[model samples]
Target: MFAIFLFVPARADAAFCKTGETVTLEGEIIIPPVIDGGEWFWPGKFAKRPCQVTTLRGKGTLPKECAVGKRMSLTGRVLDAGIVTLEVASIRCY
Candidate 1:
């Protein structure tokens, strides 16, 4: 007899990019369950994670039409899976 198995894993933190560094990522903006659970971010595909930059300085200027999984280019510092990208130099929808 043969058996099939399925595997699922818990969310993992993203690669940490130190402050003052630049990172360019393509993902969607999402609300987080971290840091009081009202955060924002540019999420990743596997974990649906963000880099933890939702409440940063340049956030207000970003056009939020990319919130619904449209690929957007976020260039800035890398934070974490629950949030990402800060000091955003540019945001463009693709």
Candidate 2:
């Protein structure tokens, strides 16, 4: 029963990307806080842009609560290929 329930897909499924569509996203990441000049930056630089996310690994989609300075990993399709940015995902003040 649990397995069957898990199989069910959620209404808000992550967005799927076309072959050439591209999107850029930037957010602070708590997984590994970014450092600049030996300082912990709440809002990291452009981290991922034009990122290619395979079925196994890719940011499908993120929550709205995620802020520019808050650590996060955005998952959007790229309108164009070979374009990436390293921006902040989220923030960890603690």
Candidate 3:
């Protein structure tokens, strides 16, 4: 009886993404323009851009290449429906 239940699929199963897959997302990476450590940046050349990936927590997505204000295409491994983990992630700025 317990074995039967174990194999049964839930009537309503909601999951973000079921598999770990890699996909290339093209967008400008941007940093929020707000005070983090009691400081705000002026919107100018120095300020970050929309398509820039400044800092990456994990591997691949290189900060040196994906700097502020660059329209880039990045490949990421999907961790969830709206979340993705970078694995050997690379970017191309356009």
Q: All models: lDDT?
A: 0.48, 0.36, 0.39
Query: What ranking emerges by TM-score with the best candidate at the front?
Result: 1, 3, 2
How big is the RMSD of model 1? 7.6
RMSD of 2: 10.8
Q: What is the TM-score of each candidate against the true structure?
A: 0.43, 0.24, 0.38
Which residues of candidate 3, in runs, are more than 4 Å off?
Answer: 1-18, 32-57, 60-63, 81-88
Residue 47 lDDT, candidate 1, scale 0-100: 26
Quote the lDDT for 67 in model 3. Answer: 49
The best candidate by lDDT is 1
Candidate 1's residue-wise lDDT over 1-94, tens digit each?
9999887667565654555566665554454212223334332442222333443323444464644556566666544445543655666765
What's model 3's lDDT at 87?
A: 29
Better of 1 and 2 by lDDT: 1
What ranges in model 1 sit over 4 Å off?
Answer: 1-11, 31-60, 77-85
What is the C-alpha lDDT profile of model 2 across 14-86, one tens digit per residue? 3334444444443344454334453332221334332433321232233445444554444333332343222
Preferred candidate (TM-score higher): 1 or 2? 1
lDDT of 3 by residue, 25-88 (tens): 4545465333346332222222122222222223322445554577656554545333323322
Looking at model 3, residue 44 earns an lDDT score of 21
In order, what is each prediction's RMSD in angstroms? Answer: 7.6, 10.8, 13.2
